[model samples]
Target: MAGSYGAETTQGERYRLSFTVGGLLAPQGRALAEMYLNRMGDGSTERSSQAKVSEKISEKANEKSDKNAGEEVGESIAAIRQQAIEENVLAIRTDSANRRVVAETTRRLSALTVEELAYLAGPDSSTSDREALMWIAMCRYYAIVGEFAGEVLKKHYLTGNTHLDFEDYDRFIADKATWHSELETVSEGTAKKLRSNLFKAMREAHLFDKKSGTVLSFLPSPSLADILRKRADSFGYLPMRESSL
Candidate 1:
């Protein structure tokens, strides 16, 4: 059966299902973050303690939009709000693996306002701004993408191929199911959803052309290049135009 993005909802969503920062929420997200920092603060100590960010988001939604805006994401908060933070708030923590990484980078990121990252998620940003957000999102994607899609990205995408089609995805899933007993055939349906959504993300990030399936080149902005340099090992496994940059 032919599949598309979000197609596997029936099978269940994949781990790397979609980019949560949809390029629409930057202003609101930023406002919310600043409010969060004001309400809670953006320091390491503050982030270590959980803030009622969803409560703020709900409040903002009610303030700005029709009352119906409150209806969505009541179930959406706990599951995804962290990814938003990861992509938007603490993005300066580029290659965080554990507590040590977080500790080492706090000097660089701690004083920064949480709302700053929301600009990257906004609509009226530059091409470089868009690329910056995409690159930041990719940084988080590497941390969270499961073994199967991660393997495909490392093995297949890192090679710099220009195109990857559905057949390639099918083969990758079949192979992952073969090697990982925990992810046996029973989960292939779930794996299919994962694969499709992962590609959807790749497309949205401009890593590939969704219409043509052509893997596009990644041109990291100077700032992004600096992050990549600082966090080279973090990105060593993933595909990019140039690693050292």
Candidate 2:
């Protein structure tokens, strides 16, 4: 009673269809494989677009951050300069010669090139030069007992040497006394304002740190100092003394 015709006919049809499909698909399959290989060898536009978008986003973010940071630094420098003016006036009243020295120092500092100022402030570092100058100028102004201590520290710092020896600092102070004679006649108010602005500028340039509230020891390089001195001379300020030269 088995239907041999139905089973045999279905098996033969399936075999014929399988052979026909395989023969037809073999070329198509080879073409698809070659297309895949070519695509793998050549990158897609989507990847390039994605990379470009990522780069643009990063650049915009950095620009925004830099703009905001610059504004904050500007405000900080303004505040420090105001304080310097007050302190400079007070210091001058106490000692005229000290006032002269401070004035000369400030004038010299103000004359530095932007690049030189950057180098002085550790621009590559976190702290700004303007902030550092503000703190040092403040220390110079208020800490009458240790007037030139900050400057000496700055010099030592620029030289990549920070010696906290009291004797050495004292010797530096004594040596600076010789330069006092070179001070020009500058008004107390003007001198104070100048010192304040100079230090503020230094902070703005990233030569000093404002957060620790400590003055860093960053001295101008000799070449940079010479450049500053020349600028100062152009501006009618006293030249670098022989000892400093």
Give the winner by lDDT. Answer: 1
- lDDT tens digits by residue: candidate 2, 1-245: 21211111122222101010111111222222222222223423232353453344334334443333222111112222233344553244545543444333333233222223333332232232233333322332222212333355445554555443445544643554455432234445554454444334333444434464333434444544443443332111111133454
Candidate 2, residue 133: Cα displacement in angstroms equals 16
The segments of candidate 2 whose C-alpha lies over 4 angstroms from its true place after superposition are 1-153, 156-177, 180-184, 215-245
Q: What 10-residue stretch in candidate 2 is worst by lDDT? A: 15-24
| Candidate 1, 1-245: lDDT as tens digits | 21221112122333233323232222233333333333332232233212354444334433433433112112212232344345444344444432222221221122222222323322334554444344343433323343433455545566766567887766765664454443453455665665565566566556567787676655566644443453344343345536445
For model 1 the local lDDT of residue 46 reads 33
Question: lDDT for model 2, on a 0 to 1 scale?
Answer: 0.32
* Per-model TM values vs. the true structure: 0.46, 0.23
Q: Which ranges in model 1 have alpha carbons more than 4 Å from their true place?
A: 1-160, 185-189
- Per-residue lDDT value at 65 in model 2: 38
